[model samples]
Target: MDLTLAQEAGGSSLLSLLPFLIILLLFVPLFLNGRKQRRQMQETQAMQSALEDGDVVITTSGLRGTIVDASYEDTIDLEIADGVVTTWLRVAIREKVAPDTTSEDDSADSSGSTGTSESKPTIH
Candidate 1:
């Protein structure tokens, strides 16, 4: 009789913990994702604040340019072309562009064969 009561008590204890376990499983991922997003936002803010003249950057709108002036408090002058400078908000800058690798990629692409593998269906 004591063994039966112990088993029943153990099963009830586990059932009581089941809801807590389910809630923990559901919230842990959300909490982690929020932390990750906050970290990314901090990194982006740091990058924007660290901008200076002569840094080559690409804008959020896909415009690639060099930073000609960044002395303003909330904006920067980007030289997109010779004698063509544009004023953009500091937040518009996405990231600094890496050194040119277009030529290398172009050479590799041209050396490979460009072909299609589609075949026409045969009529019986």
Candidate 2:
């Protein structure tokens, strides 16, 4: 009976630690998911920065456009549709188009003028 009592004490002590262990296990996956999301954001930013004129990009708001121009000031000009031109800051641009397709071949042709250091034009 004395040995059985000692064993019961040890079992309860181990059971007391189980909740803490379960909480730690749950947190581990959340931490790893956050890391993965951060990495994806960095990758997306890098891709956005690589955007140039003629690269088709989709905005965060789901506005698809071809990048008509890119500048050092973190802004770009987009032509969302035929005869439509708009200027948006870099943060507004989202996904980039797949490479190797020429923007010249795109049937949705829109005309736009590139902004310069000396001029700011009204964009649609």
Candidate 3:
């Protein structure tokens, strides 16, 4: 009888704490995701503020261009083509283009003749 009473007491205590545990589980992920999004927004703002002329960048709209003038506080002129410049909001710029770093050896291996007997099948 005493063991059954103890078990009931323990079960009630766990039930009392269940709501708090559920709330904690639900809020933890939301708080962590909000923090991560805030950090990403700060990083994007810093990148936008650091833009300068001659930097190659892509916009959020997927337009690729080179910065021709960034003298304005909130706008920049981008040269998308030869002698064609367009103004865009600084916030529209997504990220600076990274330089291609393909090594000469890799290019030569792909393009050079490998003294193999197997020839590429020609399509008529």
Candidate 4:
């Protein structure tokens, strides 16, 4: 008997695996993407649940406000402006907004240079 049978057997096995390997490569990225999306959603939910009063946040609708009350199970009270409190679902919150530290420093510097009429107005 010739040893050609063994050589042909190995080649056929590799050829059979090609389609499976291609499928695996195709699905790996999708699996990783789904897992990443799930992790991000979990982080968002955790941040929303950890919300506290006085934390500034922005809503999905692009509304920025300070958290007035977060003790409610499903609702939160937000103050968008002075004396403008509104109740919204906790899930509606998009993310926490960091306070602008640079703006405060810029405002102070701009305030001192206010003698010129061309000086821009400083916002509190």
lDDT tens digits by residue: candidate 1, 17-52 = 999999999999999999999999899989999999
Candidate 1, residue 71: CA error in Å?
0.1
Better of 2 and 4 by lDDT: 4
Best by lDDT: 4
Query: What's the CA error at residue 47 for candidate 2, in Å?
Result: 0.9
Give candidate 1 misplaced runs (Cα > 4 Å). Answer: 99-124
Per-model root-mean-square deviation over C-alphas: 8.6, 11.4, 5.8, 3.9
Instruction: Give the per-residue lDDT digits (tens) of candidate 2, residues 1-124.
Output: 9999999999999999999999999999999999999999999889878888988888989888888879756889999889788999898877886755555534323333344343457666
Pick out the ten consecutive residues of candidate 4 with the lowest summed lDDT: 115-124
Tens-place lDDT digits, model 3, residues 13-79: 9999999999999999999999999999999999999999888899999999989999999999999
Full-model lDDT for every candidate:
0.90, 0.83, 0.90, 0.91
Q: Record all residue pairs in model 4 with backbone atoms less than 3 Å apart, i.e. clashing.
A: none
Determine which window of 10 residues in candidate 1 has minimal summed lDDT. 115-124
Error of 2 at 30 (Å): 0.6
Instruction: Report the number of the highest-TM-score candidate.
Output: 3
Q: Which 10 successive residues of model 3 have the least lDDT summed? A: 97-106
Q: Model 2, 109: alpha-carbon shift in Å?
A: 17
Off by over 4 Å in 4: 1-8, 100-124
